[model samples]
Target: MKETFVILARHGATEWNRISRYQGHLDAPLSEEGLEQSRALAGALAALPIKAVYTSPLSRARICAEMVAAQHGLAVTSLPGLIEICHGEWEGMLLSEVEVRYADLIRQWRTYPYTVRMPKGESLVEVEERSWAALEFMAAAHPGEISLAVTHDTPIRTILRRILNLDQAVFWQIKLDNTGINVLGCRQGRWRVIALNDTCHLGGWLKAGEQMAL
Candidate 1:
């Protein structure tokens, strides 16, 4: 049974992230704090034998991947499957605004994400399928080695759910901070989650007032 280590990281914070706006597929540049966070993450991962790095095409994720890859002298391969779930009309809205317009749907999303689909957007099931496929592709491509996959919140959550074999209804139970790391060990199609939302690398830089979203 050959073992492969998959390190999952959420992209660093963006202005939208600071304002608590829904990023979804919208492109947002990393904030100054975000750059610092990426540097911290890169430093933390410098000791690992990262064979390759993969990222979503979105700038936030791509920037994070590039930072980490540079430390290990690995180029990043962007994969569309790792892009964030499209939030349709909610892409730029704040959570409070979403609550005002789609109260019931927002409730369903927080409580039972699998039961509600975003208007003109994707369902949790759809996100899970594509993200799981991305993970499987990485595992097959880098057997017996360690790889880094940098993506967004929803996609990371979907991958974690699949790796843990958890129901989609439990989606909101997970919390992933900006630049947070999740470790998964895969062998022969089986996975064991070693860590979830590990942000110790951020040191005291993780501000208590910072907001996070999915």
Candidate 2:
């Protein structure tokens, strides 16, 4: 059976996003703009027949997933495999700081994204292995259903690269804007990329509200 997909969206921005910090495992709430982005994305997917919703466990991804799931009156299912690649010791460090300390390692990691792991982060191969396994799991569980997977930018983007058989070196070249929707599908145990990064949901530039814990 062919599993049709409507949209797969990355979570909105967070506080760490503004500072360009490595939020590997640092769980933080979304900023005002992030919430607006989520609402806008939910509006984008409202016209589609979203059968189910999958989300990463982190706050940023979860919040975004929940927002969209609520629009469809469906509960968001947590998938550990969709979680961000853990950055370990550098979870909350600034990108510039890390670059200064681990210059060569950082360069190699960026250039050869598939094999290099940060000092304590996961390798691209490790992330791909788990993400592909998770995709297979979703495919088996929800056959022929149009669904959504709301996850972190890194993992979602990596999944796109792997499924498209693109060069790992160009992973970052496919930028996933805040609340972007990248679509993929599963037909007969195989995956196909329908769309890369999309952000038409946000309409135009949007300003966020004040930070209030929800």
Best by TM-score: 1
Please report the candidate that would top lDDT against the real structure: 1
TM-score of 2: 0.90
Candidate 1 lDDT over residue span 88-189, tens digit each = 888889988999999888888889888878999898889889998998899899999999999988888888887778887888788788999999998777
lDDT of 2 by residue, 1-214 (tens): 5665645677888877877888866787899988988898988888888888998888899999998889889998998998888877667778888788878877876778676877767887887887777777777777787878888767786778888888888977776677877888877667888877666666633432221111
Checking candidate 1 for backbone clashes, the offending pairs are none
The lDDT of each candidate is 0.88, 0.77
CA RMSD for every model?
Answer: 1.6, 4.2
Give lDDT for model 1: 0.88
TM-score for each prediction? 0.95, 0.90
> Count of backbone clashes for each model?
0, 0
Candidate 2, which ten residues in sequence have the lowest lDDT sum? 205-214
